[model samples]
Every structure is written in C-alpha cells, then in structure tokens.
Target: MPTTTGMKGGGYYDANSKEQRSASDAFLPWLEEAIAALPEPASHQQSWNFLDIGSSEGANAIYTMNRLVEIVRRQSDLPVWALFDDLPTNDFNQMFLNLFPASTPALSATDVYTAAIGGSAFGRLVPPQSLHLATTFNAIGFYETRPAARLPHFILAMHPNPGAPREGVEVSTSELIPFQKQAHQDLCHFYAARAAELVPGGKLLVQVFGRNETQSTGHGLMDVLNDALLDFVEADMLPRSFYEAFVFPAYYRNIDELMAPIREEPELAAAYRIEHAESRDVPVPFNTAFASTGDRETWSHSYISFLRAFSEPVLTAALPQDLPQENTIEKIYQRMERLLIDHPERYEFHFISIAALLTRL
Candidate 1:
C-alpha cells in the first residue's frame, strides 16, 4: 500500500478544487456562528491564533482566513495570526503566491498576519494550548500511514469475493478488520494531538468525507475509476500486477466511526465535547456545470482533472522506481476520461461529508 503524502500537483489542485471550496463555503455559516459564541480571550492577549490544517493550495484558505478575520474583528480589534499547515512537500510557494498575489500588496494588514507551517497534522504541529480555533477540510481521511493489514490487491476491499486473494482480488472480513481498527486509532491520535495544541474552551471544526452504515463515500467516483482500471487490466493495456499494487491512501469514516474514539476513550471524552456532528450531502460541481452547459467533454475533463490532481502522486509513487515515467500517468487518466465520457450518468451522485464541531474541555 502507498503511504500518505501531500497532494500531487499544485497547479491541478489549485485549479480543480471547486468541490473543496464548496464544502468549506457550506461550513462557513456554522463557523461564523461558533466564532461569535466564543468567549472573549484574556485582555492581556493581543492576538488570536487561527490554524488551517491541510490547506492544500490556499484556494479555500484565502476565503477561510478572510472570513475568520471578519468574524474575530467583530469581537475585538486584536490582530489575528493565521497559520496554514500541511505536509512538508506541499506546495507552500503556490499557496503563498495565491494568498498574496503580485499585483496586490503583502498580507501584512494591521488586523491580520499570515504564515505557513509545513508539517503533518497527526503530530504536534503547533505549541500546546496556543491555538484558539482550528479548522480542517477534506483532509482528515489521510492517515499517517497504510495499515499493517496489507491487502496485496487494492487499497480498499470492495471486490465481490471476500475469501480469496489474487491479483486485483477481494479481501475477506478477517483481513479487513485491521483497516477499521487502524482508522479508529488514527482518528484518536489526531484528536489527541489537536486537543493538546488547543487551549481550554477551544473549538475545532472538521469537514471530511463520510458515509453512513449503508453508504460508500466517494460518491461513486472511486468505483467508476476502479472500473476503468479493471477495463485496462482486461485489455492488457496495463499490467495486472501494477494495477493490483496501486492503493490510494485514504479512508472514509462514517458518523459512528468518527465518534467512536471520543465515546470509547476516557481521555478523549474528557478533553473534548461534541457540539455538533452531522452528515451533509455534497453535490458534484462538475455534474452541476455539465447540467447547466450540456457539455459532456468539459465535464469529463474537469472531473478527470480533479481526480488526477489528488491521485497522480500516489499512483506514480506506487509504480516501480525502475519503470519509465514517460506517458504512463497520462495514459491512465486518458482511459479514465474515456470511461466517464462513455457513461456520463455515472457522474450524477452526491458525496457525504461529516461535519463536526468539537470544543475542548
């Protein structure tokens, strides 16, 4: 299985993160309300700390930071310290470039100060009891590493047959248990880390992909891409070994799974209280645009571009280091685009996001 890393290409993510932006926008109203409800900080403190975890390319970060500044200023004129955190390899340059454009002046407004911190959110990214409010969107699903239960086949066990293990094979129930356990542990760790960093009464708002007991969360996007891969394998256009070995390092947790850690663990329960937790349906923007314009080709391109932006790095890393990296990546996306164009109805689906607001005790 491939290890979790930063997003693949900065340019693609910057351009194709409309879905992420929409999700963030949806949560803004709730965030604004929460900020308004927060107790005023100590009089001695001159600034408030706002941290944005996994701020991919600053597309949403720009809006989030600006909105936060607006809300915080309502209570006080104190300057706000906005910090953006992500993996070390993340495109910090692009993030800052977009955040503060060349034509505009620096983000040195007397009311808000901006800085980028490169690190993983799984660990201590900031000083303990320093941050007042924390926000993460569409990034919590990426665990620190792949689970120990290594399925030689796909990243997720979605195949029909559960008992057998072959190239591109299904995983049995016994084999899949480790992944679930690992996910629970990963979430607990993330909460613990954030709990340590946040001050008493601090609030954390998280927007991540989720599913209920009877649903699959990628909104059928992963299934469609999986089918495209299966077609390439059958046609011998790509090696079966390569296809089987490729695993995307992400896991979508349901509402129960997300709350389990806090509910079951004494320390986590004591440290945090769930203020609001619910699932929301996130419609696909590419599908909406296609519906309005009636352009299948543009929709396919946009959908493929979004997927490729996130998947390319993981897929490329999974391939053998000795293999030539010429047009191999392009071909995979090309085939995926063709599959979507052939069946446009597959694009019509909604992604479920579990939005939770937790306050430190």
Candidate 2:
C-alpha cells in the first residue's frame, strides 16, 4: 500500500495471449547482446549456471535457457544449470516445466527455485558465490509508496485490479510504511548482493524499463493500461490518489532514478559500471476501441481491469475497505465495456517507450 512517485513494478499482468510472447521476442536480441558482453569462456570445459530473479511466468528464463543450450551444444559439451526463482505464490513453476518438458540429457537441466525473495529483509535469494550469470527482464519496479498516502476509493477506479475486499475500506499510513520501506530496501540489497554472488568474470544482465529525461514511462501491456489510468483520473472519473497507489508503481526510472539505488551501495559502486545504459524506443499498440468514450461504466470496467492486471496488489492492500473481494471480476468487466464503447478514442492506440540495459559491475 506504499506509494512512490512513479510506476511501481513491471511484469504483474495477466496477458493470456501472444502479447507477452511478442514483448519477449522484442527483448531477445538485446538480451543476446548483453550476454555477449560477458567474458567469454576460456575453454569448453568451463562450467556455467544461469538464474532469473522475480521470474513471473518464466518465459524469459526458459528462453534464456533454450538459447544457452543451443550455444553450448554447438560450442562445447559443458554442463549448464538454469534456475527460475520467484515468489512461492507465483504460478509459473508448472508452466515453466510444461514449456521445457523434454529434460534434455545433453545440454541443460532445469531447476525451480520458488522462494519469496522480495519478502526477505535482505533480499538474498540465491546462495552467495554460486551463480554464474543472472538476468532480470523488466520485473524490478514493483515498489510500495509512503504508507501515509494510501487511499481506499482508488481501488474502484483501477482498471483490471482483480483481488480486493469490496466492503468498507480503511488504511493507516503507519501500518503500511514499515513494510514497504523494508521491501524497497531489500530489493536494492538484492542487486547489490547478487553482484557479490557473481564470479569475478561472471555477469548479471538486467533489461529493465527505464527513462532518459523524457516525460515517458516504461513499456509492455501494463504500461498501456497505466497510460489509460492517468487519463481516467485527469478526466475526474477517479480520485487523485488512485493514480498515486496504482499508476505510479508501473513506471520506469530516468537515468538518475535507475542509478541511485546501485550507486548508494559502495560494494557495487566500484564493481558495477553502466555497461550499456541507454533509453530504448519501444512502439506499443494499445486497444484504441475503448479509449474514444466518456461513459463512466465502460471506463470504470477498463480501469478496473487495468488495475487488476497491473496495480491489483496495491489497491487491495491499501484500500481493502472499499474494494470487496466478492464478484470483483464481474464488476470490472462491466465497467471496462461501458468505458470503451463510450469513448473509443479516449486512450492512445499506440505509443513509443524508453528502456535501458544495466550490466554487471
């Protein structure tokens, strides 16, 4: 229920179609490039291991595993272990197994590390000095805001927000701040600790949504929905804190915002360098059919759905009194359809984004 000034996190959406796949496709080449920047194997006998943190659905992890298998199979017969780590509640383990079911005997073996890394006070999920390569693709921005600023009614306006109590809601900032600050502190600690875990020559490749002095946010399905949320609030359909709780969590940091966390840690300051930090231009196509209307019901539904996909956790945690848990999905759908039909052009159909790639120290 905490509130930061900008987007909180990435990769918290329920994209059932090929949309997530498409974004991954766009990310693969840059990932390959980042991996290439790592120190090369001195010999075919060199061993390597890969880990993905905050691995929501494990698409990127699987992709990286498959790619590595291909590379090693062609170059050397070295054994490689690929691990996908995330919260225990993350429902991606079975899906990841389903994706790489063959259990290839030659190239790599898959392992699942289901732990709540974010919940840890220190955020050290992987054991120290064990990992060789790690990649986190766009899932690090889920931050909590200042505890005092949470609101209850904002939940009603968040598009796609699925889980929340529909009854009367109330939250005290005092109750929310400690937990959120701990989470944020732990997250930063994780990157710093992970940097320590890596071998001297080992590399940690991070492809996160970041900014470069532009007024833009991040990328992907959630970004589009967040943009819509900003619109709804500005039009007076939703409260201002609604934007603070839900919309701000999904944004990317500018060059300074991206570097501030890492720079604060002296251990990482010397080891880490901006290996490749630049804002990227990502063109995204939003659902324009819903944007051209002013209908409250239609817009409400869209807003709820968007919130469910991107900001549900914050809304639920911060505004439990107003957002009941009963029949939430039905209400959200009804609200979205009403909003979309009312203003088909109320939202942007397509837009471009800025991104960054941070390499190991």
Candidate 3:
C-alpha cells in the first residue's frame, strides 16, 4: 500500500544525483513562465506561499522562490515563501539543505519536507487553502501500461541477471504489469487533493512530461532504446540480476501509458481547465535556452543525455547480474557507448519537450 509506483532500481528522479539538479536548472524558466500564467490572487501584492511538490534537490524550489521574490519586490512587498515537498525516498531534503544552507535565509522564507503524493494515502505536507500557488515539474506522473507489443520486450528487460532472485524480480512475461492501475489512480487522487489544498481560485501549475499525439519522434526513440535493451538482455549480454534489480520498470510506459492515470481522476480532471498544451522541439544538445541553438551535434548530445537520464531504470535492469553491481555506472556508460558505436546507422536521436498548463478551479 505504498503510495509511489514501487518502481525498482532508481526511479527517473533517483538516477544520477547530479543530473537531477541539472535538469531542474533547465526546467526553471519554463516553470516560472507557467507560474506567471496563473491568475494572481486577489491580493497579488500580499505575500503568499508557493508550494513545489515533488521538488527534486529543491533546485526548482529555490529557483522558483528567487523568481517569486523578484516579482513581489517590484511592488515593494515582503518576499514570498516556498515549501518544497517530495516523497521521502526522493532524498531532496539534504541536497537542498546543502545547497541553501540553513544559516543563509532565502530572499523568501523556504522550507522542505518529506511527503508522498498521488496516492490513496495522503501526507499533510501543506494545509488546505494555505498555498496560493502549487507546482510539480516533470516528476508527478508515475504511470504504467499493458500493451501486448511492448510487454514482451519489457518482460525481457525485466529478466534479472543470474543468481539475483526476488519476488519482484520473478516477473512473468505472461502476467500483466503490476501497479499500473493503482499508480494511475493515485496520481489522479493526488491531483484532486492538491487542487483542494489550493486557496479558492489559487493556481496549480504542473509541468509534466508528455508526448506529441501528432508525431512518433519521442516514442520512437524510447522504443529504440527499450528494444535494444530487450535484445541485450535476451542475448545474455546482461545477467538476470541486472534486469530484476534495475530495468523492467524504467521506460515501462509510453506517453499514453503514463498519462492514463492522470486523465482518470474525475475530481482532479474537473478541478482544472487546461489552458495550454505546447510542444517545443528541444534540439539534441538540449540548449538550456532551447530557443537559440540549432547545432545537430548539440541536439544529439541533448537527446543522449535525456535517454541516459530518463531511462535510468531501463539501463539498470538490463545490466548483466554477473557484472559488479555497485561499480557498474561506468561499465553501463561504456556499454551504451559501444552500442552507439556498433550501430551508427541504426540510431536516430531527436526529441521534444512537451509542456501543459492547467488552472485550479
């Protein structure tokens, strides 16, 4: 009955502690823009608290606080406050504490707490009607699927390397994926609860990752990496231990698969009127600016970094059990490098970052 999807290996947010912070920096402007789009409270000049849910490493929280303070200072008001909350496992508390030392007061008052969201079990991280604005950047959606075409490949990816047998690892290709229904349900549930917590007419901005219905570019790259992973696992390139401990749950959902949970919550669905769903072509190197850059190599590297960051679980699960487990980060990096080198023509790396905005009813 845990609230999270119970994904094994590291969840996307858990991978490469360094990368989590980096990604947050990249997301800051988009997030600030999203927040700015929200209908301001009746007392826009009055200080109000903003909540950053699922805040990883609290970078977005810090960045958001900084921006909010700037906006408020223009009017000569007290600085805004921010609360950064995430599941205990996210380990963002210590990371942010280190980044913004306690002795150093923020431009606005800031606090961080451990909390799980989007589940049947709710944590009282923020009181009802207490927050003027709430947001989650790219980490709120933990979804699943049961597609026949993808399941087989996913099952192979789930096969643990030899000698590492656990119940979770004993996944059957014949059985459907676990926790799909519950995870989706929890997401919607959390969305609704978050809506209720917002002050009446308060804004909730969720910058979740999504796919373009019109194009297959994002889905295609995910399929390629996942399919290649399946081949590697089935070929015994990776041991069973690796799959069970790491890969099966990563890259487990296509865009549709992941969003299924969010779209199901009627209350959460009704609480917001979607204002915009925008898709911007984020070139390969993932220009932090994303607007000015057009270099192909930069685009390629950006895509590669994304594949590595977003597909952490998949890579870990496909690792051969026979390999040294803990010291395998560099080894896995080498493996990916070899794959790209081995099949230069087979790889096509391109991606887009999708953004959505919704208003709290």
- Please name the candidate that would achieve the greatest lDDT relative to the true structure: 1
Off by over 4 Å in 1: 103-109, 157-171, 322-325
Tens digit of per-residue lDDT, candidate 3, span 1-361: 3323322223333332333334234445654555555445546535566776766555445655667556544444444555666555555444356345775654443332223233222344566776777766555544333222234323332333222222333335444444444445545666667777777666666554444543323343443454454445667665644443332332222345444444655666667666555554444334343336644454444445555654554445445556634556454444555555454334543343444555667
Any idea how many clashes model 3 has?
20
Provide TM-scores for the models: 0.91, 0.63, 0.63
User: After superposing candidate 2, which stretches have Cα over 4 Å from the reference?
Assistant: 1-27, 40-46, 72-74, 100-122, 144-187, 210-251, 263-265, 285-308, 313-326, 349-361
- Candidate 2 per-residue lDDT over residues 1-361, each given as its tens digit: 3242111123434342123234345556665665555555446425556666655555445656677556544544555656666554555544445355576322243332222233221256666656667766555655533333443333221222122222233335454454445434645665677776675556666555544443333322333344344455556644556555642344344555555666776766776665555555454323333335435454444444543554545444433355434554344334454545554444322222223455554
Error of 1 at 139 (Å): 0.7
* lDDT ranking from best candidate downward: 1, 3, 2
TM-score of 1: 0.91
Better of 1 and 2 by lDDT: 1
Candidate 3, lDDT over the whole model: 0.48
lDDT of the candidates, in the order given: 0.76, 0.47, 0.48
Q: Where is model 3 more than 4 Å wrong at Cα?
A: 1-46, 101-124, 144-150, 155-186, 214-228, 231-266, 284-329, 342-345
